[model samples]
Target: MPSPTRPSSPPSSPSSPALPPELLLLVVDAVLPPNPLQLLPASHPATKTLLSLTRVSRATYARATRLLRERCAFVDSARRLADVLLCVPRLVPGLPAVLSLRHMTALYLSPFGPSLAADDLPTATRVRELLCEVCETLRRLVVQMPFGSLDPLDDGHLGVRRTLREGFEQLHRLEEFVCLGSYPALSVPPEGNTDVWRLWPELRRLVLFGVPMDSHWLWWDIATLPRLEHVVLARPVGLDAVNIKDEYFHKLPRDDARLGRDIKVVLMDLVYDLGVVRTERWREIDPEERMTVEVFEVPLPFYGDETPLQLVTEWARRGALDGSVWRLGGTRVRGEEAG
Candidate 1:
């Protein structure tokens, strides 16, 4: 002990054991619930949290990044939509390689009018190219038209409209397609053929917030989709937007050879918009057949977390008398909840 022993280094405390990958995934799912049909907006708090998690560690980054890409990527502007095609790091902590766009399966494109930039032409083209690139993998798509219409008369933001029209033409593998905000006159394909059913042969669910002008095309198309199971016609405007007539019923698949599943149509009406009702009352419009129509009096506006898509899906599931008032918000207040 003659020589003073060098001060012993303080014992290092053991780092907390890393969370199991399974448990970590559970936490991630809980934080950002997986909704393939729902788009995770980048501005959303949950989305921001998930983006931050990508930098936590290699393990967390990989899992979080994977989940983000798998879920619907919300694109609000031309530039933002173009970004999805880029090979740059989506977030900081650039330890990992750039995310590949091939993993994107769902996409929501919402172009705001107020924020429209003059140089959007090139960006819009890139997005169209991006859609072509991911067409095979894209399964669910939601296009929100805030200030423009797919109709040529109210033609505004033609680029975004073209993107939407072309996106539909390209992404034929879609299972679910939703149009929010203004009326998207997607009834007729851009090619002028009224046979719009060919757009998404694999489509199962269609939620249109605004009905198209050519309601005949809408009816005709619904009859042909072999895989179509659900159709939500919300806030029907004009005289015959969702006018379910005997002729329309006649178009329905009469034989089992054509329709393997029953087609459920939910005609949704908001509290504000009041318009002509072609059918004042409808009861099991072809109960014996493969078509069933239900009219829902949606309690709230088509905004917020409880979107028209979520409400119509819940309301349509309730097996009630066709045209009965199935109040949405809580349990079936006036109808038989489906067993």
Candidate 2:
């Protein structure tokens, strides 16, 4: 009854040793390395792990946020688009919150919904707002809006160039610009003094899908962008009839021919008849030419479920579409073309 020995408490459990700050940072880097080529989807295991680490501590979040920003996903749908926009209000009053729009490096804009054109009123406003938010950081942008949608966004007065300039000109750091879907030449009336291409001083790669093959002015815009190196003219199958004139590439003007360090004309679906002139042109290019044009025919069937962003990221990751490199003028062209 010595006061029941005061019911002595059990010995406290020992805690694990804290890792050094530098060591912790090293571990984080190992877990989430910088990937310039591809942006993993949010559902990916590595992406999920990085997101979980953001909540561990302030120190971890400080480092993880920067790494997270570099590997953001391709924004494609209205639902996914909303997810990024939802977090915009937490950090800054009007600015999009980090871990989503503000941190995004790649963006793919297509028809937001079955009934909604990308430029339909409120949708256009949202896209413009989102672009404004991410302009400072966005590096890759892929646009796949419906035909004539750009003109309607600005009351059908200014044309596609004006619409594009308003939404995209601010992205000074944009490295890759891809425009997909059928459309008239964006440079209809000429660029005048304010060349839109010059706005993206850091642009390195330009991919045009379904843009008319004869859009010489659009092709010449590449010269204005000092840093542009690679240009891809991808003609997917099932589009409107291909009205390419004979020797279209061979007769390209000297200045327009050298658009970039290397130019690639890619024809998906492997239409042998359609690719003949392009192949001939590719073979005709002088091996000593300062700028080279390489033609490719890939057997990419219709990707009903896939978005253009996925297609482009696949191309970027492998340096060729779907790992099947079919140089149109080379020995392997027919074998791949037959498929």
Candidate 3:
């Protein structure tokens, strides 16, 4: 065979076929979902590449910027959120009517210091402003209270609660409200009540992290949240913890009456000391009306000179001995349900 010859280089054109600007931008947007756009750092190589493309035409910039801001995550002081509002003043005008922080679908509010106190009003107001801007668009609001002596007094707690309640009223579209602090004062009103229920009419998921509650209140709230689907209440150590009584299920207003069938609830660290008694009671409730309780035991590690094998054996023994006794009618014992 003759020696292989290299293919001739394709001829360069003085002018190439140009795609319509709108169609080109649409193609780019179609290739990437909005999530990655939010995850990209401002100085990311990919972001720079997109920016360069935007400079090529106005349509590109419009599509790129819209995608970039669609799922924005801001973990800053309330003041920062306010600053964003002032920078984009025209974005928000009225309260409850139109939220200022509406552009964000997932919002995480983390106060820089201990507690969000009265002194933080200016920043909180700004946050409120931004929240109002995007109230209708917000689906998740996670408020993480800073650990430490943020609030030594009860007043600060009350203030925070009030602000949050007010915030909820505006977030009519909110589906999840996650509070990473003790907010026992925000207990749900008794069953058959609409006053507090109206505050979060559309709420579907509520997560309470590091909050201690009375068992009665916990079950009552679960029953009252008409549209609620998921609830996570994490208790702290050495508190008058809420345990799920077997009667927990019986107390639930008949599902067929108004609220739909059983609401599934997950209890973390349902410790034997506090939750076992209630758990046993829960087992006795009728299957049809009882609220389901799924318990998860946390493994606490002990510091000692025990060998790995010995430690594992001890752990396994502990786990096996800590089994839950289920009442005859309800679901199977923890960890025994069909996979």
Candidate 4:
């Protein structure tokens, strides 16, 4: 008959119970949206603060790691890229399983100091996998591989060529490709069936600076890209005097004549080099057709001498002396000719 032992009173709830570390991480992850980080705002305090938080606690470390690996893709340091790939599984295992690594699309590679050798192919392969895995989503690619003084005969060039060919092949989804320095020399023939043409079918914008202009006919291939609307050939060397003549106009397929028909602007700066000037015969071409060709000559000062404006003015004065039409007038310059 024992009055049934009264059940022990329920424990009183604590005023501010601590969140378990795992639960805290889950909360943080839930609050963060997995989206690619914008590269603008040259100076971002939030990014700096978030990077610093990774050092605070294990929970913060997990949260920060998830945010970075899921959103940011940078190639400033190869070692950093390696670290991110390797650490992703431990920090954010779910990311690799669910997210396409290539969606974080912009890539910047600098080969200025030394050529990337065959030994670097393993990491390059990982990068290629990441790129190809999300090829359907990539839009912009920026590569800065400086040729430096290496001879084309060296094994380094072979390695570079292989890497570039493999990498470029995977970037079939690229719309904008910017290559700085002199890697991936544009010696590929300008035939319609070339790999370059087949690789980027939708590329609309291309920027090649400080690279040799091996083939002016390559522009024909560029003109054929399905949706190419703008072309900016900057600092072109051998093909400066080359103009878009009727041959090109005719060669361009009218399959969808609308491709480059709307391309109303072109910017080119070809200096007066004897080899290029003599090799290319522009005067023999039809002036009436040439008159319709629009080109803007941008003055560049060699040996770090005068400003470009100064050079333009000097050339203008010289044109006046020679009784040539070359003066800054309305929407067009009166005397200065475009090449």
Candidate 5:
């Protein structure tokens, strides 16, 4: 009889090599996407996975802290920021930099009260100072202005801009920009707000929610922006639209080499003829219509439903179907403002 064979030992698992801090951070970026935790609710498995990364190592913890700090949507904006950040420093070991918000990158601003109130001025100023400090790294930004009140001198608009001009001009790196609540009647005065939108050569995408796309020079700015590739008018309800002239479409096969790709403009509702009312029906759209108009629904109005970052992400993916599948961009903060 053959001797009983000894039980075979199970194969041992290989240990992962220790990655350098930079590589480790890159790994975290690839997996977690800045602050993926906010995309999911607290009890969600994905949120748990992202939150778990905070404890993985000293390097990851620091990155996580910065990600959290980048977009702090306080039910109360003032004390909440300091209270949240001050407590975190003790938890993240070895990285002293995480304690200071000097490395912070993004901010979300929403005006409070019926109109910009006098008492709120100090808070607005404080927020603006914070924006100035982070101007170097800040890329994606969200500002909520009062509806139908974007007139340059409106006290409410003035109240929010207490810090806007000072810090906004400094954001040379500002890329994806979003302004919510400003309807078609509301507009960034071209004369007063030239620096607000025009200065950023790096700006590729601009989203204006609840905006009226008038033929005014402000709407026409889309054509002049050298690097702008996409413009989205969420909840747009205008008889007409502004777009790259129809002449460009006819020239596509020949001019595509020069045109490369036409800047895509989207609307939430039908494209009305330039002077038509929102309710007017068109038997047929004229072939000469200037914009490449597609009808897309603005994300549903619900808390935690859509974020400015998420809106940009969707537009980016649509603009380049074969290129970047933007699952999310910047640090998403479930919307503080609504259309």
Candidate 6:
């Protein structure tokens, strides 16, 4: 009987044939991230390199496709993204834009400034529907859409806001949701939108960079979300107690939540190094005043890079955040242990 095959090329051999599918996969894993589903963007050099390898050979193509899984999908272009997701899966859903991500799990989208959402509402609507269809299997989502005052949330001329709400209603399997830019989606759907929790039954982390929602909307049905764990706010620091009502903080449902259950609490920055989670406290304001909320990154995608908020939720449980948790009320501080 032949002995089991090994991974490395023999030392004496100056050259060797192509690596075995398993060995090639190992090499690919070493080059790319260990967990592609976390936060890698499609255009990332690592992702692009892996994508290139998919064309090496038929065997490598099969291996790469399994590895690809569209894990680190980045929607620099919504139309392009929709086109790919619509076709990548073996079985695509039947829809106007075609929905379904049979294998993909994570997604990251750059901000859809007014030019995209406002100039062409029809295209925007299709993209939104496609995303919802993909949500059937999507576990984690990172969206960087900062519409703020300009968002037509209140005005229904474009109907973009309503369309998103209805689509998000189908994101039942979504476990983690991250919103980039400076605030939650434009239309937060009044206080009652009962289906909010239904859409995200498994949600464990909800990080909002620049989530400046009013308290009424801030506390919306948070108590009903049974699985919500971390709710980090990146920008708009110093909201202190005055800006956020105490009732909102006390009402959060998951007391045994993973980390920073308090609404808009400035907790810690999670540093992902060597698989260990290290926390960084808030930066000082003007070298003297400490900011209550720590800004993660500039709201826009072009400003800087985006990290996985799940890193914060996963590692936040290990450190001591005593007298460090900064609530919206500008002054109150607590050393809440990660539950």
Per-model CA lDDT versus the true structure = 0.58, 0.53, 0.49, 0.47, 0.49, 0.49
Candidate 1 global TM-score: 0.71
Q: lDDT winner among the candidates?
A: 1
| Prediction 4 TM-score vs. true | 0.56
Runs in model 6 deviating more than 4 A are 1-18, 34-38, 89-102, 114-117, 149-157, 186-198, 212-214, 242-245, 248-332, 335-339
Model 6, position 100, has a per-residue lDDT of 34
Q: Could you tell me every candidate's TM-score relative to the true structure?
A: 0.71, 0.67, 0.61, 0.56, 0.56, 0.61
All predictions: root-mean-square deviation over Cα?
Answer: 7.0, 6.7, 11.1, 11.5, 11.7, 12.8
| Sort by TM-score, top down from the best | 1, 2, 3, 6, 5, 4
CA shift at 101, candidate 4, in angstroms? 3.4
Model 6 compared with the native: what TM-score? Answer: 0.61
Count: clashes, candidate 4: 4
Instruction: Tell me how many residue pairs clash in candidate 1.
Output: 0
Question: What's the true lDDT of residue 249 in model 3?
Answer: 43
Report the C-alpha displacement of residue 299, candidate 6, in angstroms: 15
Model 3 regions more than 4 Å off: 1-13, 16-56, 90-101, 147-161, 181-198, 236-252, 255-259, 269-277, 281-286, 296-339
Tens digits of per-residue lDDT, candidate 5, 263-297, equal: 65555321221232231121122222333444453
Query: CA lDDT of 98 in candidate 4?
Result: 32
Q: Count the backbone clashes (under 3 Å) in each candidate.
A: 0, 1, 15, 4, 2, 9
* Local accuracy of candidate 1 as per-residue lDDT tens digits, 262-284: 76766676544435445432334
Candidate 2, 47-121: lDDT as tens digits? 788778777766666667667666655466656666666765545334323454486777656535433333455
Q: Which 10 consecutive residues of model 4 have the lowest summed lDDT?
A: 325-334
The lDDT, on a scale of 0 to 1, for candidate 3 is 0.49
